[model samples]
Target: MTTGSATLSAATRRSVLLLSFATFASMAAQRICDAMLPELSRTFSVSLAQAAQVVSVFAVVYGLAQLFYGPLGDRRSKFGIVTFATLSCCAGSLMSAFAVSLDMLVLARVMVALGAAAIIPLSMAWIGDTVAYELRQETLARVGLGTTLGIVCGQLVGGLLSDTLGWRWAFGLMTLLFGVVGSLLFIDRRRQQAERLPTTNTEPVVRPGFVAQALIIITGPWSRIVLGVAFVEGAAGFGVLAIWASHLHQALGLSLSAAGAIVALFGLGGMLYMVVARQLIRRLGEQGLTLLGGSLMGLSALVLGFTPHWLLSLPACLLAGFGFFMFHNTMQTNATQMAPKARGTGVSLFASALFMGQSVGVLLAAGLVDRIGSGAVIALGGGVLVSIGIFFARALRRREELMRLQ
Candidate 1:
């Protein structure tokens, strides 16, 4: 490759790495809260419901922020906006460490979520700006490694710290990491600003016609499909996993360490998929890969739901992880490509869909588990996921065929 191309590639890699690390750190901090919540509730003398507001509010804020961050990123320097938001996350984490009451902790969680909400979608948008569509899926899988890796570390580290040092220390350590990362990013942003020579008579881009833009993106035919697919994907594996963590502990009477280790294995499975999804995507194309991904996830979920054995669950978790990423990576790539002008917005919507689906799934799983037990609830979710996957796969295939015919 030429020098300029090589330099561009290197710069892109650096930026993507930074973005991914930020995601890793943010996700780590957020997820640790779940493990730490029981301790926090006891310490603060609050009910579980009150303490859970920390998670609920954070999730809501995280989803809503994506709607704004997209347009915001479009109008400004993605690096600057992302860095600023991440710093906010650092501040929130620090505050969470020192929170004196349940309400205070919930507020801090919201702040952290708001800050973290920008990282992934902005990263995808920036990548879309820099990378071609042909390579975007694989590139995205690499970036998504942060999501799985962070989850693995968070479950492991958070459980250890909470068990030994106390839950507060887990939050404190995460706070420190976020602070250090934010400082580095702040310095990088300053350097980039200094290097960019100013140009005169620029219009200074701003969000244009917010209502109309929102309508156009949200009302498109593909938007529903994209949103539905995202919802099913999130509700399928992510929701199931969240419930699975607790189920393993309650039903099997496993210790925290054992449960965390099993959960971490799911991350390992995801990492494997990340390594290979791009190559597979190239060979299978988006439609074929998505179909395979969905089927595997459905089958895996079914296996886990029915087996009731820890060893059996592990393989199922691996398959679910692999399928989840394949489907997820394709949707993300398509989201970015759906709108060239508002790539960030499209991606943010995609993120919103996925998270919203997870939220719905969590609620549904909770209700279903109460009525029918965790095993049956999980199996039902798996069946629902399979149905959604089949619908999307067929649609994508038909679309491809029509394009060819035309």
Candidate 2:
């Protein structure tokens, strides 16, 4: 509820930095298949939507696994759980590199998703515990920068590696990245135990069961609002973006690698937003950010979807990324505060809502792409996101009055 940054130790700062890297790797693994979807389709002699099980299925497994990780984080050591989880991804990535069939690849991704499910949400929960509300948004932004950059690099790596060295090489890179980051995390945990350094987390003395904690969070009106918005955001925003590279490849006759490189600009735009997040947070406030951010993204999506010129797409994707993150970061800040008493469970529930939406969005968008065309599906997603933004902004405007009444 207040600033406790003064109590933040140097080791914790190091931990945050390490966690940032972990988040980067986690996010990178998620999007690493985006640009490779087309390549996988060709390799396995399947349809685009079928090849997309790599992304959609991973999301399903990832979202569901959060239910397990949420309560485990509350009862055990978050950092320790994260360390083990991170290491576990290495095995999955390695398996993916050797996958002989589409189904095998999907199974490998499930293994990776099972590990990666904990990385981002628990990292946020850990920050909520250690960093007070006053500093939470800024700290979360630091972690977010890693996340955004991962998006950039993931698209690039997936595209470039799949095109040149072979699609398996992308997973090879993940195997290495996860191995290294996970090891660093393990070492940090060991150091903390060795020196008996204090961390901010203390297990709740009278903590309820996971079901009760979840009920407490889901029962709150504002918490429900935040979760609902997250679901829609995942569906309309992140889920549909998965197809942008494929759309460009098929629609514009661009190489899959080139299309991916262009789409990677979206993440670069998010990195730019992170650089200026403090200014935006202070100037626009949450309501202004949501309204304006959604509008910008909607317009940009319309441009990116419709523009025939590949040159125009660069800026379109960039602006879309910037605006989407502006909206998303605000949602993240609110989620962190939604049920601070059960921060891990609350954040995981929020994540579940999000990735579940992602799974639905991918299936729907992919299914619709063949009928209406990818561009139309994309434009529709953009429109839905705009409506979500407007509704959320209005809800944010009334948040204070609503909270007081509650």
Candidate 3:
């Protein structure tokens, strides 16, 4: 597609919306297990720690699966891969709802994660293919509404389903959602294939070998830097956020549901950014947004770390959410362009680095939280995030200058 300021075609808009819904389902599946750990423990007569393996296993599988999907997306139809993945998610969710043991549940979750892995990064690659760089950020922000809402709703929906209907019903609901969305996307894919087959004006397809594409992304200095920063950003930023609910409950005696609601405010803040994305880009640009985002996140972390009352977490979470998306969205825009020839592989590696970073950060936090306390750990994360923002902002400036010179 050509880069232009023209309005998005109706079909493109529909595809984005459908992909957004698919993303929502995927994200919701990721978090739904968090609120249901106690239930899982009870159902299987296992320790809470043992039950937590469901979440851990899913994350590991999800992160690793991105490596396969990234190169496959480059060679196959991006939409086709995403649709098949969604069907896999639906099957996995159904299996989870009927799992007979903790081991079975864990296996089912791994299947779900395997499928969920492809939706976001590949959808992002699709956006990169169809949208212009200048307009891509806004398009991404708009699409982010689905993801943000999914994050916000996941805990609530999971908790509610677990409490009222039973945790199994939660998975059943997801199974239904995945089935519906997957069917719609499958139909859309058929339509796209039909439209393209008759066209003599179809664009030439690039089929770079998987190993070659991977090498292209890994060998580039700029791409390596982008991936590295994404890894650290995930670790330092999301790692702290991960423990917020536990900290609130342990430190301030807030109920689990209340603490989760406070964390959901972070998603609300992201939604706020999407509403004003166009104007924000015009006013702040990428570098300014990065600086502002990091500062806000650092401030929010400090606030959360030291707050005497639980209410303070409300605004703190909001600031952190807004800051995260500003910084993250900027990184995402850069990742899409880092290796335009191998955009899918580049973005997939970026995502893999990010998830791996989150896993590392969580491990580190788990080790330190007992000794230093959650408050100190969060404060440290804030400091690191600020440093990252500063470094990346300067790097982006240098990158822009180099491009202009070229």
Give the C-alpha lDDT of model 2.
0.90
Query: What does each candidate score in C-alpha RMSD?
Result: 4.1, 1.7, 3.0
| Cα lDDT of model 1 by residue, 1-406, tens digit | 0112222355466666777777778768656755554555678887544555665566667778888887877777777777888777877887887888888888888888888888878878777766665666777787889877877777766656666877667778877777777777777778667765222113233466555556667776666577668877777656555566555655676665566667666677778888887578878887877788788878887787777578888888778777877777778877776556666777788787776776666666766776788778778877877787778777676654433332
Candidate 3 shows a clash count of 0
Instruction: In model 2, state the lDDT of residue 353.
Output: 93
Ranking by lDDT: 2, 3, 1
Q: Output the lDDT of residue 316, model 3.
A: 95
Clashes per candidate (backbone, < 3 Å): 0, 0, 0
Compute each candidate's TM-score over C-alphas. 0.88, 0.96, 0.91
- Compared with the true structure, all predictions reach lDDT values of 0.71, 0.90, 0.79
**Candidate achieving higher lDDT, 1 or 3:** 3
Instruction: Write the residue-wise lDDT of candidate 3 on 96-203 in tens digits.
Output: 999999999999999999999999888888888877777788888877777777767776676566667788898999999899999998998998787652111124
Estimate the TM-score for candidate 1. Answer: 0.88
* Candidate 2 structure quality by residue, lDDT tens digits, 1-406: 4445555578777888999999999989999999999999999999999999999999999999989999888878788898999999999999999999999999999999999999999999888877777667777888899899899999989999988999999999999999999999999999878876544445444478999999888888888899999999999988998999999999999887898899999899889999999888889988998998899889988988899899999999999999999999999898987776688898999999999999999999999998999999989989988999999999998787655542
